[model samples]
Target: MTTTLECRGVTAGYLKERPCVRDVDLTLAAGEITCLLGPNGAGKTTLLETLAGLLPHTGGAIEVEGAPVRSGRPRDAVRAGMVLVPDDRALFRQLSTKQNLLLAVPERSRRSSALKQVLQYFPALEKRLSVDAGRLSGGEQQMLAIGRAILQRPSVLLIDELSMGLAPVIVTEILEVLRRLATAEGTSVLLVEQHVHLALGSADRAAVLVHGRIADRDSAAALRADPGRVERAYLGTDAA
Candidate 1:
């Protein structure tokens, strides 16, 4: 199977001398959901940020659709069919929901297609089109962030923290849409999630990160059944 996204020996951090993500390699196949599971401060975001070209990398490369990606070119990533839906809410507070989406378009001519697809996944956005994005609730902001990324029609989508401080019902609603993209539309997803069970439920395969490196990579079903492995890693014990 051909991979939609890959990280090859990527090393990056805030300071060039100190690398938070060290020599990491990961591959996500087209049309599949691969979950990255790890404790907070385990360098998950660093790896995702480096791959997204948000942080400057001292070495190695990120491949999206088989093309090498360099730092400081978020647009290049978007153009190459890789989009990152960041953890932070990206809505423009002053803009109405409809205007916020129009702002997502790089060119005015692109507005129609972008708005059509984005609103397809998020019908609530259509209902609240005239309202300011900031006035909407937290769940709505998250939906906007994800919808904006998908508006680019990316082949690979990297989502950081899919379930962070949201209600269980909201998280479930979000995951359902993600599943459709991976299965129906053939869009691959790389999800970083704190909710282990939710990640397992949504992903076909999963990798657990420990101390900035991949500790385990296997079928999600297998991982879920092996409580000892997950528990040991989470509790600071070596894998039993």
Candidate 2:
């Protein structure tokens, strides 16, 4: 199988502290949704950050399409076809949705209808394009954030917290959009999700992260039936 993203021995953390991610190894295949599950502070977000080059690795390597990428150089990572759609979306709050897309790809002219392609996958965002980015609801903002991430047709898409603080209905909608992207665009995805059940619902497989290391990996359906396996990996002991 051709892996789009691979990490081996990635160790990273805040300054003067134990590494939040230590000796981590993972692979995301093309056209796959690989969910990441862990308890809070298990370094889920930290791993994502490290892989995106937002955080420097104290040890190990990150490779995209088999070429090594240096750590702590986020812009280079983006240029290498890896896109991280952070929980915060990083949209221009003052800008309209269309304007945000405009900035996503400066070289591509006449992308005015870019929102249409986004809407085909996330209909909820279609109706919110003209409005200021800050006014959209949490789910809508996530959709917009994800839409903008895909504007450049990244080879790998990293998402942190797909269902955070959103209504159940909204999460379902976003999952559908993610599904379409994975299927239609052949984008490799890595997700750090708190809502285990929801993430597993749409993913093909998931890696359980515990205190900055991979503890278990299984198919999404199998993980769904017993996510407590993941629960135990991150929560210190076996779950009841």
Candidate 3:
């Protein structure tokens, strides 16, 4: 499989002296989803940010499509075909849903086509185009966030905590959309999710992180079939 994004020996955190994610090595392949699963405070978000160039890594390197990605430069990451959908969904609350999505693809000639495609993935947003993003329901807001990311045409999509505050059905629907993106569009995804089983069900592979380190790596089918291995990794007792 073709590698889309990769990080090697990366250590990142808010403080240079105190890294939250340490010496992480991960790879994402084209047309596949890799789930990063761990207990809270496992530095999943920190690792994703570092990979996206949102946070600078104190050590090691990140690459996209074989090109080195400059640390702490979000624009470089985006230009390298990487997009991040942060845990908070980070929308412009004052802007209408349409306005928010239109901002993603700034070229006038491409905006119409991009918007049409986004709406195809998220038809619920078509009727809510005039509504302010802040006024939309939680599920609708999440849909809008993912839709905006789709407009960027990213080859590698880094999503953090996709199921946060949403109903199970909404999460399932969104996961299906991710599956379609991987199968139909060949979008590579690295997802940090709290819903372990749901995420495992959708992902091609999974890495379990514990206390800022990768404790286990396996195919999702293998991990799902052996939940105790994942549990041991989460509890930081896999080696024992």
Candidate 4:
């Protein structure tokens, strides 16, 4: 498998004195989904932000497709074929869906093609193009967020929380789309999610984080099948 994203001894947080994620090591392969699972305050979001260059890493390094990408250079990461879709699902409330999609891709000529490609992943957005993004339901907004990132066609897509605040059915649909993206487009997805079962069910592999450290790492199916292990790791009773 082609390694798309790599982290070695990564430590980062809001304050230098208090790193939330410590000595974390992770590898994401192209055409695979790797779900980062943990409870609240497990430093999942901090790690995601650090990888995206939103927060400076206090130590260690990050590499995308073998090239070094330092902390605090988010655009460089984007230019290097990486995109971060935060949990907030940031979108222009007043802008139409079509406009938002168009804006995501810089090339004016390719905007149409990008829109079409993203709409294929999210066909529900086809008829809602003219509607204001803010007016869309929670699920539609999440779809739009993912679609916009898809338009970037990043080699590595970092999503903070894909299933947050969405209905179960909608979450399932979105997870299916992510699986297709990994299988068909070879996109390396690193997602931070709290929904343990759903994320493990959809991902190729799973990494459990607890108290700023990786507690367990295994194939998603293995982790799902061994719920007791997952429980121990999540609860910090067994940081294997």
Total backbone clashes of model 2?
A: 0
The CA lDDT at 7 in model 1 is: 82
TM-score for candidate 2: 0.94
TM-score of decoy 1: 0.92
Model 3 worst lDDT window (10 residues): 231-240
lDDT of 2 by residue, 1-240 (tens): 579999988889986378888899889898899999887888999988888889999899999999888889998788777999888788899999778877877766547666567777777777787999999888888888888998878899999988878999988877777778888888899988888888888899898888888878888888789856766767767544
Model 3 C-alpha lDDT per residue in residues 83-103, reported as the tens digit of each score = 999999999999999999999
TM-score of each: 0.92, 0.94, 0.98, 0.98
Residues forming the 10-long window of minimal summed lDDT in candidate 2: 107-116
Index of the highest-lDDT prediction: 3
Name the lDDT of candidate 1.
0.81
Looking at model 4, which ten-residue stretch has the lowest summed lDDT?
231-240
| Candidate 1 Cα outliers beyond 4 Å, as residue runs | 107-110, 235-240
Clashing pairs in 3: none
Better structure of 1 and 3 per lDDT: 3
Cα lDDT tens digits, model 4, 1-240, are: 999999999999998999999999999999999999989999999988888888899899999999999688888888888899999988999999998888888888898789889988999999999999999999999999989999888999999988888999999999999999999999999988888888988999999999999999999999999889999998889645
The local lDDT score (0 to 100) that residue 135 gets in candidate 3 is: 99
Q: List the residue pairs that clash in candidate 4.
A: none
